[model samples]
Target: MATVGAGRDAGQNLCGCCDDVVGGLPTGSDLDLLREGLYGCFGGAFARELVVLSPGSIVLAGNHTDHQGGHAVACAVGSYARGIFRANGEGRIRVGGRGLPAIQLDSADLDARDGGLDDLSAMVRGMVALFLQRGLAPGDALGFDAYLALDEPVGSGLLGESALELAFAQGLNNLWAGGTLSGEELALAALRVARERLGGSSAPMWQLPVALGGIQHLSFADSGGAVAERIDFDFAQEGYNVCLVEVGDGRVTEPASCSSILQEMQAVAGALGAERLGDVREVDFMMDLPVIRDQFGDRAALRAIHFWREDRMVEHRVRALKAKDMHAFLELTRASGASTAMYLQGTPRVARSQAIMLGLAVADENLRHEGAACIHGGSPERAILAFVPDSVYELFSQGMNAIYGEGACRAYEVVDEGASAWWL
Candidate 1:
């Protein structure tokens, strides 16, 4: 059996530069945010003892999982999932949380190998199945005993829970098999098992970027999978800043809206037979206005349109980064945020927060406000964020700290290294 511990040296292995960028201690507010998000998404009572696995590890695993039509992006943040696990030899699984009843699932049911093992718990089971299916193990000889922990109080815009699951699966596989896999391999393996065995809904697209770190553009076609291209942008050297601002009013629901937007965008792309909306350049807005209106009538459609166009802008940013044109890059980033607010009709909460952040940036004597940007359908509470050069991070951090109070905004040094795996 695999018995995991919250090691004494936990968090010590974190990159010093990352710690410096996010500031010292992980805030309590961050943990609260994560707890709330976990309840909302997973409906578990609560999470405790959060654990943050290295982003590098997750990224490496995610990349290795890539199939003909799969790609993932992930980031290792300052926070992680918090919880503990104990193996029950009685062929039963029991989970408990605050203000919630303990959830029990029989190990017999899990071992059935039927399609019913397709829920969250099944995700863990699927990893085990994959290990055996791949001939990496002789049998399900051991069960998992684990405790999840987190430093970040709240879930970031991305599906952090799944990220945690990926990390846990990786750690468990390593421990049980007494062997190591590259990060990319683990990520791909987990993704495949999750989709095929656990019935996960999302495409394997978003997983890689978060795993790998740095900015990336992803594309998926047909039923094949997806591909990712790293956008070569240097936030540290560039004279501008990138920040993610939270719109505290809470109108934005990322998972709910992002899926709809992606579906609509896909339909448009499929109908046009173009890779993305930006491919339809030089068309008069007035000429396409009726079609655009018919297809995407609501504000959500407008937001999707903004994403399509901004995707093209991201391509431009990629070029500018290559050319080392800092001015152009900053301008594009700001323009992207403007597009989000004006075209996409971002939530009022997000708009207000962004305006507040912009004001703070402008007032800063040392830092110039290059731009503000928000992901489509990002959590309304944390709607808008920005990117800034490393030179100005120190100068601008204080202003953000004052506005965000604590645990609101964070800064991280941009790393050029793409995703890869390391083992202990």
Candidate 2:
């Protein structure tokens, strides 16, 4: 048998655009590291026979609005949660990766994960169990050993968890089911795992972009997060780069703190007899604010107002992108950011970081010229999403890292693919 990690061709050419999407082709050494890591985890069997999956997204517009079935513009970034898998034939599943301990569980015991649930293990088990419940298997008749590695940080609200869920979900499907699931199905399935098992805050907003891939204008209906209109969008032709600046102070923001944004929005929607804020017209919402105020108070009224305006901003931004008008899009993004800060008031945890990001957007010529930056969304996030003219991208990166520290900024190229898997 070939030694572990001996053959590198297994994952090569799996993603045709990996080089272009991953900031130019990875060097031989980079590929070597990937292979070496695979070998180190599972030896020759897993290294020689494996599958790879990538997660993709950067919300260009619409923040904390998708759960309300609102419009959102999402771009697919190159970063991935690569899951390498091979059938174990032992009816047990094993998972391992960087910063994650090797986890092994009998196929019969996956449901037992809840008793002493380690968050990550429960997540993996939950994902697998979800698939099985849907009458799908993660591999052939045999179970599998999987290894996951992410190029992005967890809990930055950059869709890292969503990416992991999609990558694993799709990878398992491809391995066991011959990739029969459609893109829409895979995306929805992953969202279900996040919502049902992980108790995630946002699913459709994050899952759709990551699962569907590419630059998309996702118009979610006022209904409860099921219906969506997907349209193609392009920003590269206009020489713009999407940069996600991780301003995290080395801590993951808790979901409990950010949960109130959606909860309050939902409460307002319920009071308005609407499923989501989007169902209430701007004029109607304003006219009804007094009635809403009496019950939910001004805080809820203001948050609901932000939702209405945020949806409008997303609609306008989508039009701007479609018209190839980058200027108007940036303006709308700035307005949306301001509204988030002032009206929504859901970013208390990252308020200081938000201030620092807004300051950079206004003061730094490199960032300010033909670019706009914001706190990413109304939900508490440690990162800011900035759209910079390609000409100033490098300078913008330098400026951000100088302030936020090196490795804080990442420039993502929107790609045309999503949650795909391949077998070797």
Candidate 3:
């Protein structure tokens, strides 16, 4: 709703951290200094305009928030942060963010780049610095304003915040300076900026799903980062039902503390030279169960082992679904819920909510009994996925509304479109 234009009359001060020149344009003398310093470093005179979208909620399969690492899924929402630019002929960079703050960067010292200004505004500047360091044309001085908007509902468990920021950065690169930057290149650069510049690593996983979508099974290899592969399945014709239940009053939180659990998992991984937990197979889990229990105390160890096994079961079920083995998929879904209840020690509220939903779906006379349901792990809130007959879509909707109260959950038709870019 708010609009800011780039000009001295706008009456905004440059961010001190970035050493941006604010208020009034420089005369011929100032332009001379700028030209002398920036000409060689920036290469040529160019300008660009760009827009970026935010990322949605992050779903973790295993506990651990602090780089201990776990599997997660995220999507890019419709909202965005945008940047518009115009070359000033002089070496001056002006940036404005709607309803936030404005920043100006003066490239007066090409040989001496300040590294102390670390903040959100500095992120864009840092990206420019990085580009220059790589011997790429850093573009010319320009006047620009950045705008940000988010479309997803607040607190939806989607990583909208991180996604939007990264999208904006990528959009800038693609729009302003035309070049071929692979998805992996953009992802890695965005990840470093989010971590080093933004003080967080949570943005990486979230950005991946937005950049690449569809039903993907993701795994991160230590030396190689994340590896994503699409799972091929025709849900529409296969007659499989998938429902996402919103449980726990929608107050989602990160997974439980995982310091000790990660240490134990690491030990197991070390023995097998497996870089990731997913690489540890069923036999590895059984063998390391006792060691994990000893390290994490009995209860935590038991829950961790249970989740590991159940997660593997889910992965296998995904494979079964791909193979169109409906019976095996249903059985595994039921097993997954049971394991969460007995071994993972999921909250009573979550376990009961999922159980009741699945039970009702199975008992319904009109609804097919060949469906499957299980709790969606990672979110603090209780949520479930039900695989049901497509013919009963309306019936299932009505039944869920009747039981859980109206608007308790949202329903979306199953989609298979992989991630793609769109105008905001």
Candidate number achieving the greatest lDDT relative to the actual structure: 2
lDDT of each: 0.45, 0.68, 0.46
Q: Per-residue CA lDDT of candidate 3, range 138-250, in tens?
A: 45643333444334332344233444445444544444444345555555666665555554443255555445434545555343356555556555567654555554443
Candidate 2: regions farther than 4 A off: 1-35, 46-48, 112-118, 138-140, 222-232, 248-254, 349-366
Model 3 CA deviation exceeding 4 Å by range = 1-143, 159-162, 197-205, 237-242, 250-291, 346-370, 399-406, 413-424
Residues 25-53, model 1: lDDT tens digits: 22344334434544543455422233234
The full ranking of all candidates by TM-score, starting with the best, is 2, 1, 3
Better of 1 and 2 by lDDT: 2
